[model samples]
Target: MAGIYLHIPFCKKACHYCDFHFSTSLKNKEPLLKALAQEIILRADEFKDKIVETIYFGGGTPSILAVDEIKNIIKMLRENYEVIQVPEITLEANPDDLTDDKIKELAQTEINRLSIGVQSFGEKELQMMNRAHNAQEVKQCLQTATQYFDNITIDLMYGIPGLSNQEWKQNIQQALDFGISHISSYALTVEEGTALADFIKKGKYPAVDESLAAQHFDILVELLTQSGFDHYEISNFGKPNAYSKHNTSYWLGKSYLGFGPSAHSFNGDIRSWNVANNTKYIKSLSENQLPSTQEILTIKDRYNEYIMTGLRTIWGVSLNKISKDFGLETSAFLEKQVEPFLANGTLVLKQNQLKTTQKGKFLADGIASELFWV
Candidate 1:
């Protein structure tokens, strides 16, 4: 189908605002990678009839692995699945890990895209987030990575407590200066268990300002749009032909298999995720058992997922599909539900597709939740 996602659950250090499942310790790395490979082989039967179009290496820091380790995983995938001739293989990497030598070696692998985590170009922002990479490393990695790969996307964060609108613009400009084709920009959110949240609670750090974040988001969209980049998804921007195929598949509701601890997978109806604990995931897979829990989605669940994703993308929700799949009752209910939004200029209906207006872009998730079939 659309892709396979491998979660490399190891990071050099934890970012202050992240809540994703990852371990900073490398002690279980070898076992984890081995288990990751095993899990891929074990799940091959699940999608035997499907041809994979993309392979995404996500996570704690996929760049933390050596080139050979990365290669071995790709090798296992090749042995197990029917990957397309030129799959959109992506590696989520950090700046410090992508040395000149490392980039050279990665260029030789099947990986054709790099999604680098360069949270911000400002040293204060980087330090504030406790990101492993420094300002200089961000610049260095981009310059060197461009030399080797043309398809590159960088992650940028905005709305930090001390960051100003001007500094936010500068961060976007820095990415543009590198000729970066794709950008995944996000506002700094303090997840409940993250260090940032705890710090804010303890009065050691300031809380995130929603108005400030909205300002940053507006600037980002305006700047990137003027630079000839398409605002493909709410948090993603890309030049022509540079959008992330793997992630696009997700927004479009295509099935993909995720390997490694805390990874998720979905078929048309069933959604599953591996255990978040590294040791438990490895132990189960070692015993030839899948370490995952799954649920068969109900009609209401599917409709809600579509509404959540569709409104966030350039391609909005299709009323016709809703009618056909969930029947006219659901479609009519949705049409009725959207009356307030349509009248307020926050939504538009065109060719049977319900889309978010620019004013509603930042509030897509909220809008989707309100529209869900409760």
Candidate 2:
């Protein structure tokens, strides 16, 4: 099965730590929507023989659009693609846009999931992140959203400079209180060229502390797992059978088509990404051409990718699958490489699947990189 990702590259304001491609201006809004629809139709042939299982509306900020605009886009995809019956359609939204009325409107659409961008529930953290929604809006949005969407997930961030563990605990508790089924949490990082990075460079803000982030990660896993949420992926927690099928497909190496500016697509081997420029993306599609670049992933590239993605999930890396696909030598190499982590009790081999132990999870990325087929 395959999935479709449509990027809506417009936002009301830029978050201080965000570097995703987007424009605050709505000047090209009409053209962009047209281009997005056109691109979807243009790429429909690629997935013509593939069953489309998921449709994800990701962004700049997907909620920035009106209900009709979203409906039109979903309608276009359904008309052009061989979408499965009762496909999982998700829309990423900001809390500010999800008023009670808006939430009610969204529930009537084909969209069945809401991935709200409630980065933090604390007023201080909200202001620090330059989020469009305040603590009150966050609460109000969740209260209303839970009424409509059962498959709801909220984004949460940790490791803010002044956010104490007590505050973080409170944040986790608040989400639980709302009965959100999924939680995708991440430790805030400073990306270069973002306002947060500049602030740190100019000594206007404190640099992110990794040690503190580690502490928060521990707290997050402990609390969520105790609450009966599965830490299925390093950055995601979901109740049983409520994991994000779209994202889980990515980790499992499924093919997907990504449309609009700055979106990426994969076809089991080759991976491609569209230009980040909206004007260029629209202009190219106006001429019925794709404005994207692609690369054919080598065997090593594929193996390394599987290793990186597999190690981060509870499914883990399958030794037998590696041996069958990458040959005995490569499999032997992996087994040797994994020894250090296994010996340290950071990794465990269970039923031929190598998975991270609680001690190794926070360091999964680093460990995966070391075992890369360099």
Candidate 3:
């Protein structure tokens, strides 16, 4: 099944370590939303009639939109696309924007899932990240959201410099206490040109301790597992039957349509992304021209993608599927190469699937890179 991802390229403030494309200005929100609707209608033919199993409203903060604005987009999707009868519609929201009234309004929409950004349960860390929400708001927002929504997932950050292991433990406990069925926890990474990077350069903030980050990751694995959450992806944990279908589709290499600035869309072989500039994207779409660049994945690129995605999930890489898709020789090469990691207890060979062991999860990216086809 296919999916749709709409990027609302606007935020109230910039987080220090964020490298995503977003504007702090709401000057073009209205026009951009309309343009996005048009883009969806215009590009409906791309999917050829695949049922959309998920529709994700992700961004700077989709919760900022009014009830009517959100409903309009849902209406547009229903009219243009072959959406699943009970599609997983998720909206990524910041805690500050999740007022009771807003949550109630959102509950009335076709949107069935809420992914709240509750980065940390520490006020000090929240300020350090320049996040718009405070620790208290995270609890209140989740409590309010639970009143109306059951399919909820929360985004959390871990291993911020100066955030002690105890504090990280508190954050995990807080998420569990809130009764959120799904969680996406990630380590803090300083991207180039981000304020956090500059601060580290100036010795204003401590450099990210890789050792400390690893410790925190281990804590996450232990706690989440004890709490009955499956470590479905390296960063995502879910209770039984609560995995994120939208993101899972991406990892599984299923095709999806992405609308709005900085959004990327994929159809079997080609991938395309809209311009990162919100103004440029809106202007071009207003003129009835979609501003996007396209790339066709070579066989090597496809095989690399498969290897990268397969190793990160519980499902693992299917050697038989790889042989069928890429050729027997390529699969044989991977089988031989992976034997070393398997011998080291970092990889496992079960049935026809090749999966990473628990010890291999933290170094998943490095391991995936080694398996990449030239």
Q: TM-score of every model?
A: 0.99, 0.99, 0.98
| Residue 342 miss distance in model 3 (angstroms) | 1.5
| Residue ranges of candidate 1 with Cα displaced over 4 Å | none
| Native RMSD of candidate 2 (Å) | 0.7
TM-score of 2: 0.99
Q: Give candidate 2 misplaced runs (Cα > 4 Å).
A: none
Clashes of 1: 0
lDDT of 3: 0.91
Best by lDDT: 2
Shift in Å, residue 204, candidate 2: 0.7
Predicted candidate 1: what Cα RMSD to the true structure? Answer: 0.6
Task: Write candidate 1's Cα lDDT for 51-167 as tens digits.
Answer: 999999998899999999999998899899998889999999999999999999999999999999999999999898898989999999899999999999999988888899999
| Global lDDT of each candidate | 0.94, 0.94, 0.91
Off by over 4 Å in 3: none
Model 2, position 215: C-alpha lDDT score:
91
Q: Please give, for residues 1-374, the per-residue lDDT of candidate 2 as tens digits.
A: 99999999999989999999999999999999999989998888888899999999999999999999999998898899988989999999999999999999999999999999999989999998999889999999999899889999999999999999999999999999999889999999999999999999999989999999999999999999999999999999999979999999999999999999999999988999999999999999999999999999999999999999999999999999999999999999999999999999989999999999999999999999989998
Candidate 3, 175-294: lDDT as tens digits: 898888999999999999899999999999999998889889999999999999999998999998999999999999999999989999998799999999988888898899989999
| Backbone clash count for every predicted candidate, in the order shown | 0, 0, 0
Candidate 3 vs. true structure, TM-score: 0.98
